[model samples]
Structures are given as C-alpha cells and as structure tokens.
Target: MHEIISGLLEMTGFSIVGWETILMWMIAFILLYLGTFKEYEPLLLVPIGFGVLLANLPGAGLGIVANELVMNPDGTYMTLIDIANNYGILNFLYYALIKTGFLPPIIFMGVGALTDFGPMLRNLRLAFFGGAAQIGIFSVLLGAVLVGFTLPEAASLGIIGGADGPTAIYTTIKLAPHLLGPIAIAAYSYMALVPVIIPFVAKLLVTKDEFKIHMRKMDREYPPKHEIKHMRVVKIAFPIVLGLVVAVLVPSSAPLLGMLLFGNLIKEIGPNTARLADAASGPIMNTATIFLGLTVGATMTGEVFLNLQTIGIIVGGFLAFCLSVAGGILGVKLFNKFTKKKINPLVGATGLSAVPMASRVANELALKYDKSNHILQYCMSSNVSGVIGSAVAAGVLISFLG
Candidate 1:
C-alpha cells in the first residue's frame, strides 16, 4: 500500500511545493468566513473570496498560460503559440478590464443612478463638511508613504479613505495594479462595514451631550411653489462645466471626474434613453463589478498579500478613517460657533467616502436621542458632500502622483 501511494504521488508529480498558492487559499477562506458569518460586505467579499479560490488552484488552468518559448510535442511553434493564446483567459480578463480601466466608471454610473443629489442641494453648506471630512485621504496618503510604501503603492493605499469603492479601484489600478486585490477587498469590506466602523469613530469625536444636540430644521429656501425642475439647460450645462472646470484645470482628474459627470448627464438628460440608463445601472454595471472584484482578488494570489506593506496599508487606512471623522466633527463645531446653529457631529462620520450608509447611521443615532429628530436631511447633506469631496481629493492626488 505504501509503495502504491508513493508511485501514485510520483505519477502526479506532487513533489513541487507552492507556499504562495497555499497562503492564497487561506486568504480565500478568511474572506468567505468574514462575508458569511460576520456579514462584512458579502456582495463584494464573497465574490472576491471566490476569485481568490479560483486563482490559487495549481494546475487547474486557473491563472496560467503556456509559455511561448517552449516547443510542442508535434515540433511546431505555431501549435504551441495557439495553445498558449487559448489558455490566457484570466490574464485576458485582467488586462482588458483592469489594465484598460473601463470597469470603475461603469460601476459609478450605477451609483449615480441609485443616488439622489437632492439632499446635497438642500444644504449646500453641508458640502463643506463633506470636503473637510476627506482630510483623511491626504493624511492617509502621507501616512502610507511614511510606512515605506513606494509612492504609487502608497497612492493606491491612501485612496481608501474616500469610502468610495469605484474611486478606490480606479486609483489603485492606475497607481499600483498589483496591489488591486488587497486594496479592493479592504475598500469594499470597509464600505460594507461602515455601519460598524463609522459610529465608533464618531462617538469618540463628540461628548454624549454633543451627540445628543439637536440640529436645526432644514430650511428649504427654494420657494415652495417653485418646484426644482430638472432643467435641460442645467442638465446639459453641468457636465460640460464639470468637465471643463475640474478636468481642464486638473487634467489628471479627467478619468474619474469626466466619467462621473458623463454618468450624471446620462441620468439627467438621458430620460429619453431610459434603456441606456438601465443598462448602465444594471447588467453593464454588475458585470463590470463582478469582473473588477474577481480580477482584483486574483491579483492577491498569496505572495503579494503576505507582505509587510499590506499590513501597513490596512493599519494606516483605519487611522486615516478615524482622523477623518475627527476633522468632520471639528469642522462642524467650528461652523456652529459662527452660525450659532447646532450641527450633529454624527453627520461628520458620513463625511468619509462611505456615502449613504454613514448618513443613514447618523440619522438613526439622532433618532436614538430624540424620536422626533429628522436629521436624515442633515446627514445626507454631509453624505453627498463626502462623495464630491472624495472625487476632488482624488483629483488632487492624481495631480501630485501623476
């Protein structure tokens, strides 16, 4: 029996070892456990875990392509070339979607469709709060550099504070494509876990008395009789203005800001093209998301993720997020001193790129203090502001990094 087992192992050529491959499988398991049990961004983490699983299986034809340098058994270079060409599906997927950088904006179109900009317009001043909140992104960027990440790698790592997955993916792929898996996983995992993460940071920034402070009623200054119609001129003009003002002024920001404005225009004026909107918001977006997550996870492949640098990114990311919460609360408190109107520090937490989730949490916390509290408006103002602030910060980073 021992001889037979040894013979079988030899026949299968099982002597070669791959520690990296084994480590990647462990990563897959951890991701799956977190997504399934802890419920940490299951939509993203679960898919990412499966991708990691797919990439690590040796001889499974998962992450391989035949070498073009080798001759075939038939003594034909063409045959070997044909086989190699046919086998690079995952590689093809990675380069086509990730390297070409088409997926993130497609995902953003879906986000824009799902988003309502009304709250942002309702309290335009709150946008400043959102902008202040993203101080974490720059802080995180500097922190990542201090931790010994290469500039491009640090740029990729720092973008996590945006609380925006698409932006994170776009920036990371451009700056350090190899780090995509850990960065994507971290970005989406934190986004999904925002409900758990932001509240703790928020609570620390304000006293219980401050947390309990009631916000003033939202003043709808636009005349009640005058409905804010989606004007065709404004719809047409806004994207063009954004493209020129932000894109031309900060050329490196063109990819993200241009596409974001493009998607918004589609939402605004493409009312006649509901199909285009649906496509952008539905299968087109979802397909891109799956591919984006899978390809990013594949990049992890054990060896890349085991580095000391990855640990530093995660640690710095969390600190950046915490400090961002502080900035938002501090900004709000400063504004309140001049305006003499209360601003809930909880709303500041949403200032990081986590968007509606942070806003919803803030609103819920307000209601906890007072059932009659209608702080959703205020929370949303900060939430949307976070979105724009993150985008602008992305532009600024691209300028320096480019």
Candidate 2:
C-alpha cells in the first residue's frame, strides 16, 4: 500500500507544501470569483483564470518548470541546455502576437469591415472630438512619470487613454514588455465597462441643456443598401488606395490599415464566400478573444501581479480613460461655439474606448432626455472617428517611442 501511494504521489508531481504555490492558487481563485460573481470582464477573466490554473499546475512546463532536454533523431531524449529551444508555441505566440505586433491589426480589419463610415461622413467635424479624446493618452503618460515610472513604462501605461486595446498592447510590448499583461487587462476591462464609466463623466461635463440639445438632420444620405451592389470593383480600388497611402505614410500602422481595408474589401465584394470575413467578426474573433484574454490573464501569476507596479498601471489606465472622457466632451462643447446645428455633448462621451458601446450609450442618454430623439447616426460617426484617432495616436507613439 505504501509503495502504491508513493507511485501515485510521484505522478501527482508534488508532496510538499510551499508558500509560492499557495499564493498562486489563491490568486487564481480570486480571478475566478471576480469573473463568475462580479461579472467583471468575464469573457477574458474566465479564460485567463483557467490559463493561470494550467500555468501553476505542478510539473507543467510553464514559467516554474525549466529543464533543458534534447530529443535525438530516434526520439531518445538527451539532458542538455546547449541545444536550441525548439517547438515552443508560447514563444511563437509571444513573438508573432506580442513582439511583432500582428494580432491587433487583424482584429482591426474585422472591426473595419463591420464598421459603417456613413455616420462619420455626415459628421466630419466629429473627427476633432476623437482627436481631443486622445489627449488623455499624453496626460496619463505625464501622470505615470509623476508616479515614478520610467519614461518607457510611463509611455506604455499612458496608451490606455487612447481607448484602443491593440494600441495599448502594442505600445506596452514595445516600451515595457513586462507590463504588457497588466496594461492590456486594464485597457480591455475598462473598455467593457465604458457604459458604466462614461455616463457619470458625461453628466458631469455637460448639463441637461447640452445633453438634451437637438440637432438638424444630416444633409448627407447613405446610398440605398443595394444601390452599390455593383460597386465590387470600387471595393478593390478602395483597399488598394487606402492601404498604399497608410502603409507608405506609417509603416507601423500597416497592420491595422491592412486589416481594415481587407475587411472593407470583403464587405464590398461578395467573392469572400469562404466566410472568412464573417468568421473574422464571428467565432474566429471570439476564439482569438478568449485566447487573448486568458493568455493575458495567465501572465498575471502571483510574482508579477502581486507587485505594487500592477496597481500603478491599473490606476494610471483609469485616469487616462477619465481624462479622455473629459477631453472629448470639452472638444464637442468647443465645437458647438461655431456650428449652427449643435450636437449633444453626450455623444462626445462615445469617443471613449468602447466603440459601439460608447455610441449606444450616447444614443440611450439622448433618448432619456427626449423620447423621439434619434442620435445614434451622429454618435456612430464620432465612434468610428475615435477608432481612427486612436490608431493615429498609436502609430505616432510607435514611431516615436519604438
């Protein structure tokens, strides 16, 4: 019996108690509790929490397991550290997704395909609102510095203000790779909470007068749904032209630009029967999202997440988002001075990180003020404009910092 128990224990990997394992397990449970009960970024948190569990498992080849071994041609193993480290998907994922900056652009492509630019075309002036909202990014950079973060670290933390997750992640990977996980989680978590966050800030910035302000109907008209059915040729031209211009101007933005253009092409041309376009915005996107969230969460193992710096990143990101809200609303209020037809300042809040959610919130707020109000069209323009603005800001940061 004793011998049999010993064999089972060996397979179990550990028979000893240690503080490190205990700490890691506790952190995992906390993540689970928050995701399950509090419903805080659950889609990501749940996957991430599971990843953490896998990472912390005894004898797993995660961070804690490090032994050098080489497999011979016949499959026999050699104990060695000198041979090349081969077949590490984690390393590949890190390099391809995090280091080379690939995933964000692919995500953006899907975003662009699903996005409708008509709203923005109708409200061209709203581009300034998007620009103003990005000012918070620089402000948070300053705040991070004041709080004792290094220049590079501060820059990474500041990107959260752009309200763009991929931008934030890309900047952090280039500037402060160690902080990538925390900064990314903070950025996305806050984005999901935009509906809750922007309201108080919106109400505070603009009075009922501004929130309830009415505007003239857009003079611009979108083409009938099938009016451009034969414009498939134009789709190809659009991507070719926009991709060339953006790629030539900002090589760093090529990824996002390429993705956006590809998505648009897919939408314009019906030839994408492979359903790649649909999948890009559907299950594929969801799967990638789950992987991204959990992988990011997994990086928050006890040793890294338990540090004071993690707290700093979270606080810095929050401030960045808040400042962005203020900047966007202020920009709209300033614009109101010149235009004869005024936009509800509430729509400006949609300039924050959550793309459609921000726009939806603005419309909802507008409806609350007046039942007959239909502000979504205008709010959507500002929302898409925010995406561009965020991407532009991110490109600038990458060019200057990276």
Candidate 3:
C-alpha cells in the first residue's frame, strides 16, 4: 500500500508542478486581467492570455510541439498531416503558419489596405523623421549585443522599437524564434500603451513653446508653388514605383513590403476593387490576428518565459520604444535649426508605427497646449512612413544577422 501510494503521487502531474509553473500561471492571469478589465489590446491580449493559460495547465499537452518532426526520413519537410499527427494543434499552428514566416506578411497586407498614403506623399519632408525613428532599432541592437545576447537575438529584440507588431514578430521568427514570446508581448504591450508613453516622454523632452508650433499655419505660409497634377494617377503609381525602388535596395524586404504595397494598390483602385481591399483588411486580417495571438502566447511555456532573459526583453523593449520617440523628436529639433519653416516637435513623436493611435496621441498633445494646433494629417505622414521604415530596418537586420 505504501508503494502504491508513492507511485500514484509520483505519476500525477499535480505532484510535479513547481514554482516556475505557478509563476507562469500568475503571468497568464495578469495578462488576462489587462485584456479583459483594462481593455488594452483586447484582440491580441485576450487570445494570448488564454493561450498562456492553456499552455501552463498541469498535465495538459495542448502546448507541446514535437520539435523532431521538423523534417521527414528523407530530410524533407513534414506535411501538415504528419505535423498534426506528431505535434498537437497549437504546435501545428506554430510550425505551419507562424514558423514558416507566413502570417506577419499577411497581416502587413491588411495594414497596407487600411493605410492612406496621400498624407505621406504631400508632406514629403516629414517622412525623414520616420527614417530617423528607426534609430531605436539599431541602438538596441548594439545595446543587446553588449549585454551578452547573440546578434540574432539582439536583432529580434531591437525590432520592438519599430512599434509595429507584425514587423517585430516576423523579425523574431527569422532571427530568434526562441525569443518570440517575450518579443511579441513586449512589442504589442508597448504599442497598446502609446497614449501614456507619448505624453510622459513629451512632458520631459518637449517644451511648452515647442508644442505650440502650428503645422497648418506653417503649411499656409510656405505652400508649394504647384499642387501635384493628376493626383489620382500619382496615388495609383506610387506603390509600384516605391515597390521597385525598395526591391532593388533591400530584396529581403519584399516578403513584407511586396504584400503591403499590393494591398494598398487594391485599395487605391477604388470601387472596382473595393471588395478585394475590404476582404484583405477585414475578414482576412481578423482571422490572421486571432490565430497569431493564440499561437504566440502558447510559445510562452514556463521554462521559456520565466527567466532573466524575459526581464531583459521587457526593459530593453521599453528603452527601444522610448528612444525611438526621442529620436524622432530630436530629429525634428535638428531639422528646425536648419530650415526656415519650423516644425512642431510633436510631429516627430508620431514617427512610431503604432498607426492612427500614435498620430492621434500626438495630435491630442498639440491640442492640450494650443486649441487650434491640429496636427493629425501631418502626423500621419511620418506615421505611415514609419511602417515602411521599420520593415526596411528589419530586412537590414536580417540581411546582416540571418
């Protein structure tokens, strides 16, 4: 009877549960609370939180992926059928979709369909700040290497600065798949906290007078001598021209930029192609996001996520985010010194790729200082360009490290 009892206890999963598992459970609960109650990135956080919960459950094999099934007997890639048989559903999802580097570019296509490039085309000068914003990516790359990370790991961590979740995910999967859980969580969490972070940093770096620079007023005083003739034609041709230019310089970026530009092209074609754009940005994007979130969260097993490395990712990711914002602000400050038409520093603050949220936050900051200072349109110029800039930066890292 004593031997029987010992065997039963030893065989039970509950008996094997350790402090690491408990900690992971707590982390899952916290993420759930943030997603449910706080409403921070509910779409992403909710799925990811649930995935984390499912992965940490005692005795459950839902999160287990058979890593050995990567290749077959002849050294060929396993079919999805084989993967499903050897690996579980979550594992299948990770290997088939996320691991193959499939979904991020698909998500980028949706982002492209939803994006409006008109603002960026007109305010060409403002686009440089977007390029400047990428300074955070390279900055953290060196920072991570100094702190003892491999180049690939550092490259993956650095992309958190881009503030574009899909870009960060794609980069990590290519360069440091092991760090995906931490990197993805960090990237999306920081993106969600854009409103709070932007204001906090603006308070420290931007002066009251600097916030009051009226972008619209400056535009009126220094209007271009001529309006862009055949605006529709220009809009139609922009994607094609830019895609070719990007392809020549950074061919690796094609997987991301190619899809993005194609999505935009469909959107620009107007009513005749509205159906394609709608499907790309709506149902297709939504489905991809749900699967992406759940699978990414499942990757955060207890042993993987509960470590000093995750702590480093959390801190380093935040620094990358802040430095990107600071870089954009300082870039504009430097530009202001050289040019006669002064720019509002808040315009630079919108250079992160958090989309309309970043632009909206900057616009609100401007309004707080002066009621008439609406900078949303100007903000979008850099905001959109930041999307392009971050992808290019990711390609650069991959080319160098991968």
Q: What is the TM-score (0 to 1) of candidate 3?
A: 0.95
TM-score of each: 0.86, 0.82, 0.95
lDDT of 3 by residue, 1-402 (tens): 999988998788778689988888898888889989998899899888888888887777666353555687787878877777766788889888899899999999999999999999889889999988888898998999999999999999999999999999999999999899989999989999999988988788998889999998998999856688887788889999999999899988989999999999999989999999999999999999999999999989888898899999999999999999988999999999998899998888888789989999999989999999999999999999999999999999889888
lDDT of candidates 1 onward, in order: 0.73, 0.71, 0.90
Candidate 1 residue-wise lDDT, 1-402, digit = tens: 999998877666265437777778888999999988988877678878988888776655555232233346677544433543765566667666676678887787777665656666556667788888887888887777876788888878878888888888888767777778778887887777677776787777667767776765424322233345765565557666867888777776677667767666677765686677677778888888788777777667666678877788778777766777778888887776786456777777678867678888788877777777768877887887687678777777766775
Best by lDDT: 3
Any runs in candidate 2 off by more than 4 Å, and if so which?
A: 1-27, 33-41, 64-92, 216-240, 271-274
Show how many residue pairs clash in every candidate, following the order shown. Answer: 2, 2, 0
Error of 2 at 236 (Å): 6.8
What's the distance in Å from true for residue 69, model 2?
14
Identify the runs in model 3 with alpha carbons over 4 angstroms from their true place: 1-13, 64-77
Q: Of the candidates numbered 2 and 3, which has the greater TM-score value?
A: 3
Mind sharing the TM-score for model 1? 0.86
Q: Per-residue lDDT tens digits of candidate 2, residues 1-402? A: 999999988888586435776777776787678788988667766776676676666665443111123346677543323232452444334444545566666677667667666566546666567778888888988888888998888888888988787677767767777787778878877886787778878878888778777654423232223344434565457567877887888877676767877776776666554387787777766766666655565566556666899889888888889898888899889888987667678667777646788888878888888876778887777777777777777777778877
Clashing pairs in 1: 162-353, 163-353
